[model samples]
Target chain A: MLSKKQARAFFLGGTVVTFLIFIGLTIFSLSKGQDQTNHEGITEQVVRGKVLWEENNCMGCHTILGEGAYYAPELTKVLDRRGEGYVKAVLMSPVPWNPNGRQMVAYGFTKEEADDLIAFFDWIGGIDLNGFDTVVSPLAKDKIERQTKN
Target chain B: MKYKSQKVAYWFFAFSMLLLVLQITYGFIMGFARIGFDGLHEFIPFNTARAVHTNLLVVWLLSGFMGAAYYIIPEEAQRELVSVKWAYVQLISLAVVGVAAVIGYHFNWWEGRKFLEIPRQLDYLVVVNVLLFLGLILATLFKGKRKTTTALVLTMGLLFAALLYLPGMLPFDSQVTDSFFRWWVVHLWVEGVWELIMGGILSFLLIKLTGVDREVIEKWLYVIVGLTFLSGILGTGHHYYYIGVNNIWLIVGGIFSALEPLAFLAMALFAVNMYRKGEKKHPNKIALFWTLGSAIVSFVGAGLLGFAHTLPQTNLYTHGTLVTAMHGHLAFWGAYAMIVLAIISYALPNMTGRKLYDSSVGRAAFWMANVGMIGMTVAFGVAGVAQVYLERKFKMDFMEVQAEISIHFVVLILCATLFTVGIIMYIMDFIKHGKPTDEELDLESDL
Candidate 1:
């Protein structure tokens, strides 16, 4: 029979060992050499656009990088799927953009803000999402591939 | 109740219940919105509703955990809490922070991060409030006559939970990095330390209700929590698989995530075996139901359903779809929510000196809530599977897929209504117990 002391040791030892490994893995993955996150692409416009995204809580509705409320479309590949012009138009629209009857809160953003958001989308669209982009947004993938072929 | 200070737990439980009701209301709003009843869209948009719903779940569960600590720590330590006055202050501040966060969500004053959207300002207040809470709990435990394993584990869990919250507060310019650390708080708390808390509470409850030997229960408690951290710590990789992280997570997460169910399975088996071995069955049938239900349901909900989509291959499709929600709702309900409710059910009678332990109302509440929740899970699973097929596999338009699957939301709403009725009855039972009376202090031994 396992004693209480041994059980406690098992708990403590498992916790410490696994925690160290988790930390090591985190460091390894985030290191610059292993960087798939495209951290350098985050320009001033992209930062401001991210600020806008956060301020409006756009993630409440839309998912980016496959994380969100699942209420709205995933915006990770929005620039590829909709093109910059349509995205810009939607952002700058004075009224709620209800293209499919699901109303998006109308911010009526200035063109500069819209441009910044577009830049953010462009940056996000460029990241290597380990095939998630190709899987989730096949249409956008097709569009990008077609454009490259052109 | 063992001590006058334990009476303070009643107020915390009351506040937790209040927040739970509000959380369910926000849930209904989102559910209704899903099925095209977006009348509240102008006021409470889907995003706002979602933030409120998730944040409120976190708050209510935290409040309940605090209440459980307040109730259990004093008893396990065989002493009154260190400072009842400070405990109340902590409770009030927690409620204040919770209310402020919910109200802020409505006004769009949030950090826009899912689950961690309480804004940086309120996050500071939360830290202060939690620190005060830990100080009181730790002081009581250390100053007591004897230190029990249950008390230490519970305190450790609380302490670690507070420490984990700091990672979520760290700023990161890269969204991927931000998300990676966000799981450090959310995933670690739920899958790791929170299980310790759950184990502590379960050990306490089993000792009291099952008349089981404390040594036996505490031994298994250690084993259960050991299994939790062993698998759960590296299981954090499951979230990193496609989130712009290294492929290392795919292998690490897949193996660890598969092993994750073993913890819940151990938990369930431990609880059932303890019950069968128990010679003295305490009269608190409702609490027993919840305790046992929490173990079994969590195994099925958190363990099995989670495994259904945890693999990187499957998660590639179901990553952000309704499948995650399907697992999330049941997992939180079975694991955290039910445990909190079980402790409350067990403590209320002792605190208020009203032994409404085996009431029909309580029994009804138990069955209705469980059945309703299972129904809701099924609805979500069907919707999510259909979504994975039409949207991901078949490459249908997102909106088109939503329209096709909106019927599941209708089913979800119906099941949720039943679940709400169960909660309302439980509240009614709670009200019947009235307020905790200091006169009942140390009158009847907890066992």
Candidate 2:
């Protein structure tokens, strides 16, 4: 077996390397990336849709931005995958669409409300989360407020 | 019972058991809700129930740790605790804060983060509560006759765990940034420093129960500490993989987290080896069983199962699915939960001068809980694999996929019921032990 000093040196070296990597990578996550781009172009309707999404706890069933429940499909890319018209139709009467499916608890949105959710989905889909660490910009400080107020 | 003040730990543990009951009750509430019971939907929605259940788990575990520290430190350091009055006050404050947060969750006054949903206003109180606990533990350890390695490692684990909570509290406007720091508290605590605490407690228990040499056990404690930090600190990257962090985590996390099992493997090996080497046997069979069980099962649950999803390739499909839930149920139960129960089982009879270790219910409690949790882990595993394939691989509709797996929740409830019964029997045994008495103080001493 190795001496005590060798064991200590090995342990110390490993701890330092691992800890530094963690600190360095955390900095990389916050500071870098195309995700730091502004949330500038989100329209009033889209923002209203964001508020609607939160108030309804769409996350209770569906994952938005990859952080919500896994019960339903991830809505982050739903607009692209399902298309706006189909998303609207599903949101319009979610229960009948999937009669024997997992419960979405029919919120019974009107066509306009469905359109708002689609717009919100469109806004989320445009962002480049690149299949993981879905970074939302801190620069979009007043974005939620602007939507709710509108 | 070596120290008069150590009796306060009994109250802390009793409080912890109360919270566990509430926690399981809420788990049932949600389990029923999952199967379309939904009677409590208006009052306690699934999300609210979820937050309460998880928060209670964290609180009770913290309480258990505090109780363990109180019981272990005084004996290890060869001194009575510095203050008994302040310790009781701290326990009450912890209970009050824990209860208030649970109530706050039902009213939707929470931050809506997964585990950090303690409503920031109350987080300040938790900080205060933890500081008071550290103050007492550190004072006792430093002021005592001998500062043992076991005591110091346990203290360090508790201290660092408190410090990690600050990152989660920082005002991060970005969700990605918020999640990055959140893992510091979650991953770092469970996979990182908490292993140190576990090692320290295991060392103490092995020394007492196995009749092993103190020097031999403490030496293993050092190796465990080294392995935990070597892998776990960087293993935080594992959670960072798909969470919108930098892509380097994919490699860094995959490599480092895969090595985390080594620390746990060492723990299992250490315990078994210590038992084999010890020629003299300790009479506390239940405590020894729990001690050895914690070491072995933690390897299987936290070590092997954790490794199962640690690699990027597997985690990509299993990230937030039932696979994560499966691992969570087992690792938490196997590692932290079992160790806490081991200490309590060891300490309760010694504390209250009641020797009930030979009872039938005690044996039943241990076996049923372990068996039920293992069954629950398997059910979650099957459901997780099914969900991953149907939704992720086959491109099936998400709702249709969930309906397909609703059957597993049925099995989950059945096993959870058994697990609950085991816990109840354990609590009843605790009650039977009565309160600590001065007559019992002569039963044991470390130095």
Candidate 3:
């Protein structure tokens, strides 16, 4: 029979050990040497784009990096899927962009704002997603084929 | 009620009920929107609805947990709350912050980080509100004659929950780093500290209802929470995998997440065994139903269903689809939501001096809610598995796949209506009990 004191010790000791290891793993993953996050690739335009993405709450409808409301399309590889021109038109359009009858809120963003978002998408599209990129956006497969042919 | 200050918990429970109704309303909006009846699109867009639904859940559950602490602490500690006035202040401030954030979400005044959407400015106020809450709780616990394990664990859970919120607020330019830390708050709270809160409350309820020995119940409480952190801390890696982090998370998250169900299994077994061992049957049958149901349902919902999609291989296909939604709905319902309702069911009769235990309406509420939620889960599960096949595996267009599965939302809406009826009845029973009375204090000994 395990005593109360032992149970308490097990709780405290296990919490401390696992939490310490979690911290170590976080540091190891985020360190520049092992970094796969493309931290240095974040330019001023990309930063502005990220800001616009959050400001508009694009994630409310659209998923980027496979995290969001699942209400709209996943935009992790939006640049590769939809060309910059189509994306910009939708962003700058004065009316709600309803594709296949599902409506998107109309922001009527300026050209600069649209460009910044596109830049953000471009940056997001460039990251290595450990094969998730291949699965999520079929157009990524197309883009790879195009690159190989060229 | 042992202490007069325990009467304060009724008001919090009342507040929780109010928020819960509002939360369900927004949930219906999203469900309708899914099936193409999005008439509120211009006013309450899908994203706005999503933010409100999730944030309200966090708020209502927090309110319930705070109410549970307020009610349980005084009894377990053998003293009244340190300051009832300050506790009311905390409650009012929480409502203010919660209301302000929900309204802000409507006006595009949010940070837009999924669950942590409250703007940076409001985050500071939340910190203040929680700090005030913890101050009262901790003061009461320490000032009392006794500091039982149940009180300490619950307080510890609340304290760690507040600390974890800080990580989500930290600024990060990299989306990867930002999301990585976001899980520190979100994942850790649900899987780690919140389980501590749940265990504490479970032990308290079992002690009272089961007539089991306090030492035995509290000792099992320690083992369950110990199991919770043991698997849950490393289990944060499950979120880390495929979020642009290292591959180590794939292995770490997979193994730990598989072990996660063991904790819930322990909880279910403990609760059932305690019931079997109990010689005394306190007459609060509704509370017992919810308590035992919470344990069993959580094992199936949070534990097994979560295991259904948490593997790296399966998650790769079901990552952002309706599959996650399927698991999340039941997990929150079974684990957090039912426990909150259990405490409310148990405390209400005692607080108001209205022993309306074993009402037909109460029993109906229990069955309707559970059956309705199970129906909703099945609807979501079918929609999710279909989504994984058509969209992820077959590479169908997203909108095309949605059109194929919109029928599930119709089923979801029907089941949700049934669930709502159950909740309405529960609230009706709550109202019939009326307010907590000072006269009830010291009326009877502990059950």
Candidate 4:
């Protein structure tokens, strides 16, 4: 037996509160996340490589920061796993590495371009991402203990 | 068509149908490509096809929403539309912009953003076109005799949706920053404001088709709106969990998003209860079916299926998998797409002065589309679970995992065929309704 006036008031109040929560969480997350993603800071090469990555639509296949197609392997941690030289060789010739038809197109990058990409991968590799999956998240107990000590 | 200007909705609907055909064509191309049939790989690659398919689906839905607003506002406001000519102009501009963006995608002339791929330059055109649309609707509503809650909610949704698009357009050098604001548009629109639009349309159809008192239905509308905000606003956190965001979002997103289903569940119950309480005097059986179907199915698709992976635990392995595609197809179909079809089904006969309601084709369209979509959801769910296990859990190669799940896409294509057939029949019936007439303007309310 909800009356129209009651319904209106209820909706208006609930909406304002919900909006506040969303905004609060977004600001909090953005402050923490942006700091973490750029912790290593961007170099000229990293910036140029990011542009090249976008221009060639590298994200069309590989995910950087876990936000692209699932067709290919992740590139965010490539520098850690494959090293700079390995990344350079793969970019120079992608078919030998991913030749199962779902392969990267031949980008024909110059040496400087490959070096820039390597720098970009190196930058992202340092980002914690706080472990995008929950599997590697710092335990709640550890966080609580640290906060209490602080 | 209580107002002569309401005839403009016809063209918007016709345009939406045209885009729908193109959307399905792209869907078929991608579906075939999933199974090693890479005939169009050289020119229309999977990424390009995927972008075109998703973008067309979005535009068509927006066009449908705009049409619904044009048709509903004049009638609810009890006035002629402020400007019918401008509405036609808006439609043509929308089509031109859509075609330009689609063409640009082929030659790599667009932004690489997944859904927001219409290059920043064209985003300005979209903003201008939507402004014209909002101006007309707002002007007509203000000039009309009565301003109902139904009308206001729909208008608010459209206004907020337009405002939210600005955040996505802002330049950001950080990928995380770009994605953060992208969700402001994507997550907020679908989960937040769009629900308001759906509620308004559902309320209108329930009023007309169920013969319910307006007071009763609008009361439920308030509740649905309340619940939508209460849950859906925070529910955006579900996406924030694994996108290089704060770890706190994992807990917040899990709890709030899990509650998001309650809103859809409430809508389902509200529509069903209203139908039970009211006398069915309007006699548009097909429209009623779609109205009730959208309500119930949205709960299953957007609510139940969404909850399946909303928890951080499940989403850890399932994020961006076909599980998302599963929830996406169903939620869009059940919530937005079905509501558009319902409103069109309800409005067509009224506008054209026809009563072709209980035809075999219309009923078949309702059942086949629903069944086909449910089948597709099941297929995606199966494939998604398998992908999560094989790739995420076992560390298998991405290509090998995709190959193992290729068989499920076979099921997806078969069901998509049936869904396509149902849509074709719906278009046939739309054509059969012909065009709105001035003669029908003076007709009595069915209620």
Every model's TM-score: 0.99, 0.88, 0.99, 0.93
- Please say which candidate is ahead in DockQ: 1 or 2: 1
lDDT of 2 by residue, B234-346 (tens): 88878877765567788888898999999999999999999999876876788888999999999999999999998987887777677877888899988988998998998
Q: Residue B33 in candidate 4 has what lDDT?
A: 79
Candidate 1, B-chain TM: 0.99
Across B269-343, the per-residue lDDT of candidate 3 in tens digits comes to 999999999999999999999999999899999999999988999888888888888889999999999999999
After superposing the true interface residues, what Cα RMSD does each candidate give?
0.8, 6.1, 0.9, 3.8
- Error in Å for residue B263 of model 1: 0.4
* Candidate 1 structure quality by residue, lDDT tens digits, B1-447: 888898888988999899999999999999998888899998999999999999989999889999999999988888999999999999999989999999999998999988899989999999999999999999999899889999999999999999999999998778888899999999999989898888888888999999989999999999999999999999999999888989999999999999999999999999999999999979999999999999999999999999999999999999988999999999999999999999999999998889998999999999999899999999999999998899778878889989999999999999999999999999999999998887777745655
**Per-residue alpha-carbon lDDT of model 1 for A65-141, expressed as tens digits?**
99999889889998889888999999999998885678888889999999999988888888888889898787787
Model 3 interface CAPRI class: medium
DockQ per model, Cα: 0.84, 0.21, 0.80, 0.31
Interface root-mean-square deviation, candidate 1: 0.8
Ranking by DockQ: 1, 3, 4, 2
**Candidate number with the higher DockQ (1 or 4):** 1
Candidate 2 lDDT, A5-80, residue by residue in tens: 4544665687788788777767766664535323554677776776566445555545655565555566656654
